[model samples]
Target: MKKRFWIAIPIMAFGLGWPLLAQENPTEPQPQHAQAQAQPAVSAPDVKSPGTPQLDAADLEAWLDGYMSGALEQGDVAGAVVSVVKDGRPLFAKGYGYRDVASKLPMDAAQTLVRIGSTSKLFTWTAVMQLVEQGKLDLDADVNTYLDFTIPERDGGPVTMNDLMTHRGGFEEGLKEILITDPAKFITTEKYLKDHMRPRIFPVGKVPAYSNYGTALAGYIVERLSGEPFDDYIERHILGPLHMERSTFRQPLPEKFQDNVSLGYMSASQPPQAFEMITSAPAGSMSATADDMANFMIAHLQQGRFGDARILKAETARLMYQPSAPHEPGFTTMAHGFFSGPINGKRLIGHGGDTIWFHTDMNLIPEEGVGFFVSFNSRGKNEAVYGMRERFVEGFMDRYFPDKGNEPLPPAIQSAQADAQALAGKYRSSRRIDTAFLKLIYTLQQSTVIANEDGTISFASEPGTKYRETAPGMWRDPNSEGALHVSTVDGQLTITNSKNPVSDMQRVPLAESAGLNSFILFGSIAVILLALVAWPLSWWCRRLYGQTLGLTGRDLVAYRLSRLLMVGDMIYLLGWYMALQPLFQMQFDGFGTALDPLLFTLQAGALVPLIGVGVGLWNAWLTVRSDRHVMAKAGSVLFAAALCGVAWVAFIGGLMSFTLEY
Candidate 1:
């Protein structure tokens, strides 16, 4: 019974948790596989070099208007605030469309408060660095040293502050209670951290999975060390010093600031939605204007000083922008908190954020003394916000830093047949769940890397796109200059896009891929539903014709049990699916209580279908031995196999677990 329970739990859990199970195993031994490329260097742009610029103010504005205005009109986004700072001064800052469409209130770049999502991590990282500068914290020291609670150490080692900053802490992703709708549900940082500490999955300092829990932990540590609340610490040291008077981390907008807060919308045409409350406040709960964000950007671009106020020494500011961990050899790595990537030959550091309704991006070209910030008030479909950001940044760089004929690309390798074939497999993103139903979503999003006949690799997720060998282990898109580096990390083949290392995906074992499993799962469900309808309809027709089911021994029992198991499994699947609908609806206040019974029912009910595996075989064997119709024998055998596949797939997907730990 205990074994049966263990098996039953994950069948449903895997339905959602398969992708999470594919997350990197931190404790797994790292093999000494020789990598193909030298470590990529961080190119420090000439800070004082007047970079070549072919665009005047008019050209820049015209290009931006064309892109932003059209995107706002097409996407579900209602309004946006854009700001560009060059040489520590605003080159352009303005609002597009209306913040409150019903009231027809136009956005004010400097006054409208918009939730900046994970870009709030910049403030948290900035606080940690400030503490480091003041000798209150150590970057390499065990983070547990400053925390009231211990972050369980894995084989890699105790996670240091630097690991948290670089998102290498190896903490499993937690989403169940991360985003809540009610303000009352928002607990203090101390309580929230203690209650929601996630499992440490990967070995410390190895996997580059972005961890909101790790960042929030950093914030809690700041709260402990500074002897101030996390919200107060930022206000006193960072926001106050920079005079970002309108910016805040507080939920439930303060009385004076309420009128200025923009209504968050799900779509440009839909009615406004409730303001979001992220339980991990430090990781993402920031509300600030474009003008306020510009000040924060200027402080970093100027090496920690905004006008007369300084947040950090010039050296500390530089350290904050430096890469923290290099996951792939010769690939741009994650900086302290910012993601390091290249845009048109320039090395830049930045962060992007999104809540349910708002999308925000803040980027800085440290060498050019330039920064860009943009925020949208509505949660748009089609990813228009992200598309706009990518285009704007690339356009800005192309116009300002016109590429003069530069270094020649490494000669294209004529042969990479073996390597490309070896790389052809399914890869899962590290930023996924290992314990929750949300893993199902990630599983569907897994990318298939296919080795083409032309000695190039294509990704199923990005159709009509192929990456060809430019150098050993390096592949470049023929249509675009973007590149990808393929190498073995932690004994697994990994790929990192030139755009963002944080979005890298690692290859997984063949058995772990969900393609075959998902196909079987859906196929078996369809077979069962068909059998249910056919068996009854055939029985009714036979009764009318005065015919009957022959066989009154184990064959009859086997047939009855087979149908029962199929129906039982269907109920389990449909039950869990219905229970999960509210989870996706953003109404999560009573999720745990609501999910408990469904989990319990599924756990016990899963064993009912396990019996079908055997009964199905018995029925198939009997039909094959008897003078039954060929279709009947074949259907019996196929149905049994489908039953076994469904259960096995469920188990592998992490749906078999009995616990509510997720």
Candidate 2:
């Protein structure tokens, strides 16, 4: 039920026939050493000029500031700083709201230090690209050859550097806890390979799985080949060249800098917690100011040039922007980045970052020679970030690329009732293991089902049945279908079928607990059938034969049933123990013999009651057949006591709480 919402913005220029304007003044004077300068000296835009450019600057600043204010008011951010540049020049830069609510400290453009999160990956990529240009490292070479230790093979083939860079390595599928708590236990790229060598989720280069571990490995490889620590190498090569003095990779804040760093907030309920410096620093652990990030974006916008200093050859910069693989249609995937896509019709490139307590976005409109960077110091609604970015982008394009017309909006959903009714239906799909085990069907209703599909569907008020589309060709019946299992790949739909042989079934009639109800019904039927068969057999035998001889059948049947039930109980106990084994082992003074009491209680407690119940019933049958009133009464009392004891013990031990509904 926990869904991570990622705002995927199409970096295409809005509106058709929009004219792209270049920001760099052709008639402006230039210094003799400008071409050789490594960092550009930034200055505020000249707003007093009587020209179209001046009007554009005012519109751009107002648009950006308005969105920032709206975002803060919506409780989607504690504070934010935004910087916009045109042709490697600072057009507008400002900060809004309190960085630390408890201290009542307002964020300022010069002082605020925002965590850029995965935007740090761009610097790492730039460093690696520098190495590639120097001919010191090969992108396609086997990465294990340069590692301090050996990288184990997956199905006898080593994962290449390209695989790591593109996230094609197959070691990303396991549980993250194995690495989160004690990273050193699985730190090295070589150790990770050795541990997960033979297991592969997908074939190399077949699919792109966004992997944090794989990126970390790439960082390690960069460090090893350069004979320097990863952070040190980046600081020396990339940051130093760009003159990003305040930027650092997980460095402890100095007393002077502490006041400058933003206090990142999550939801309003709890106070903000200090962000942890991750061991996997390469993926997303760098911190910087809006000015520093704006400079970085300017470098990219100018095609690897900052003022006169060229960090990379123009050809190399072009290669970085070139499509590395197929992404969504009309969009292209760059080297670990996103490139331009068809929106209205213009070209744009950008990336968004979401780390704990922060959301950031960096975008560049190359044709217009305009770029922008926005960072929020809060874990707020992702939709707010996306909406703000879209509005800013749209306003900028209208000013700079006015020739392009506005993009057409998709048709809106008018009637909720009509929409819900059209989406209800039966859906099915096969599982990887068993094709027949996965057929799923759902009955639908408006109150019972919440439609998750994008398109319109009809809804019925009475007996409330509605149809909801999860994807094209996939629909869920609101009356019968509870939670429909659906997947979308490039707008194509795949629905899970529960009736299939290998399926993991989903509940229909959305509000009902179908699986738990089925289990209870099956258990009740089994208990009744056992008693029914035992009672009839016991009576027939006593009537035809003597009491002692006739009781053998009942005794044998009871013995088998008790053993079966006890085995089932033991299996359940073992599973529970294994799940909590990590916690027990982690606790103080608990060693190998710690689980003994738990094991014994489950075994003895479950077995004794079932055995006692069977014995008492058998004895009562014999007494009744012999016309012994006293013996029959005693047997009945014993049976009642055993049942009561079983229920009492189960309740006290917290087992009965499992059956209770929330």
Candidate 3:
């Protein structure tokens, strides 16, 4: 639910036939607080340079109105909240549309609590840093030392708290109990992490693979050291100090704030979904009013002080600001917990949060003492919130802290076609399962880089954006000024760009390219189905025409055996598809324990191709060597080859995996 960029498909475009939710004064925003009036700019110690526009509440609110009005109407989103803080003062806060569509309850910037997803991690990180400020936690020590449960060490070393902070713990993606409406599936962070511990696919402190379990592990550590629940520890140390009164990490929403929580929707045109329960609560489970979020953001912007309260010390906050992994001039890096980057000529630290329905983004400019937070209660048609958040934040930056122009291209741009060509290929995200059936899903979502007819290249992820080589291996997008840094690592090209370093893209070999995999998948299915229909139809046609019995012999036996193999292989493929169809629909119910029997059946059925393909090869040999008709020989060879492809695909795709870890 982090809205990982690896997925090219829409996030929550749940298909429904219901009419759009009705609203009174649909175009006009209903606010708990009226539109802010023009007021003098809040006193900031940092003065603006010449020609900088004054950021006042009236101007900010008016600008937000022009944007959100059309955005909600066009995108079919129900409601949203936006808050901006300048220096140590809140500059603007407003809500747009309805919080409860059925009751026509308007969204309230001060009262409507919206689930802020992974933004919850920022609070968790603050809690951990506070403990580190005391002597309760060690940032560099093995995390296993802090836990009652053991997390086995991966290659190089045991996962340290720093590794979890930087998201370099190398844990494979955890999908079970991620988002569930079933309260029965709801489990604590400790229970989920302990029961469903993931294997480390990458070495410890190496490769950026986003892991919710890692964050949960960190949260659990805080839970153990503080002698309290994760949620309570967060509220007492971080939220309480920051005075984020409306916020709570509690799953069901504390009883008092329950009525104020906004209903999340796949789309405003569709019915509302039940409250999303995140088992990995530490990673992404917190709801708060936009105004409360502003307070939290103000603390970070002012070096962890909010009025009389302090959540993180100045030194400790600065430590969080330090990049855990810095790249070349215009590439990506991760701070201790924040995503630190060079954006619009300013150093920015921020994090994006996403749930199944709600989408949220938070950003803070330490140098400017400016913080911005926005949340959408609906994913909208085609998950429009994802692009909306990025464009909104960047638009704000361009409007206020305007960049002077694009960065000057390096000398390498003069003749960097060769390097650009070298970078053009299929790339897969490193946050992938190494050995599980889930890898098949990752394969389909792999990214591609194509060398344009011109000297520029483009990433499939950022369509329409062309990047020219600004440095030897750095391709800079002129539009966004984001650069992608590609280099060979361990004999394969791994790319780290201006995007967050939660994951990097690695070059995919041609044999394992998604294109090839898709080709084999569809082509084999087509061939198998064609063979299946023809075998039955051809025999019926021969009998209808009163033809001979095809001269019964080993040739007949081979033909019959081939049909049997097709039947078994086809059944195997379809069975797996039936089991996995839910995932294709972007639902995770099929991954729960309830589907274990179906999964086991599919895994056991993998033996179909394992044995059938061998028998198919023998049948092909028997038919071909028997001086059969030219058509018969060709059909036998093609049939055998098609089944062989299916078998190979099954093997490499991990359909043969007997475990349900994926």
The candidate scoring highest on TM-score is: 3
TM-score of each: 0.88, 0.58, 0.91
- Candidate 3 structure quality by residue, lDDT tens digits, 1-662: 01123211122211000012222343432322111112212334655568866778887877778888888888888899888987577778888888888888888787788988787788888888989999899898999899988986678788889999888898988675566777766778888888878888888876887777898899999999999988888888887776677889998667888877899987788889888877788888899889888888777876777776678888988888888764676555778888777666777787777777778878888877788998889878886766676567767877778776775655447666777687788898777776777777666567888887677887776658877886667777665656677777667789875665777789998877888888888888898899998977888988999876464776677677777888899888888888777677656544677777888888888878877687778778987777669888788888888888888888777788778776
In model 3, residue pairs whose N, Cα or C atoms come closer than 3 Å (at least 3 residues apart or on different chains), thus clashing, are: none
Candidate ranking (lDDT, best to worst):
3, 1, 2
Tens digits of per-residue lDDT for model 1, 1-662: 00000000111110010000011124432211111011211224543236554334565567667767778778767888877766656566677767788997777776678888888988999999989998999999998889777877688988999888877888877665666667766676576678767888788876767777888899998988999998999999998877787789987667766777788886778898887777778888899888778778777888887776789998998888877877444345678887775555566687777776777777888877778888788756554555555555556676676444445455568677777898998898766677655555555457899998888888886667777888887887766545688877788888876655543578977677768667877888889888999889989999999998886888888888888888888887787676667555645444544467887777777686677787888889898998888998999998898788778766766566565656
TM-score, predicted candidate 1 vs. hidden true structure: 0.88
Worst 10 residues of 1 by lDDT: 12-21
lDDT of each: 0.72, 0.49, 0.76
C-alpha RMSD between model 2 and the true structure: 13.4
lDDT of 2 by residue, 1-662 (tens): 00111222111000000001112223422112233234543433433323334435677666666756665767555777777777567666677777777776776655577777656667777777777888877877777777665654655366776666555565422212212222223243334433433234444554444454565667777887788888789778776666665678744444556667888776433477554344456755678777677667777777788765667777777777665643433333445444343333445566556555556767777665667777777655543544554455555555554433333323343553454443354221111111110000111111223443544343222234334444343444433312233344333233332111112222233222233333333353344344446656976888778665333565556434543443444354354455345333322112112344554454355554455455545544544455445744564444434343333333333333221100
Q: Model 1: number of clashes?
A: 21
All candidates: CA RMSD (Å): 10.9, 13.4, 4.8
Better of 1 and 2 by TM-score: 1
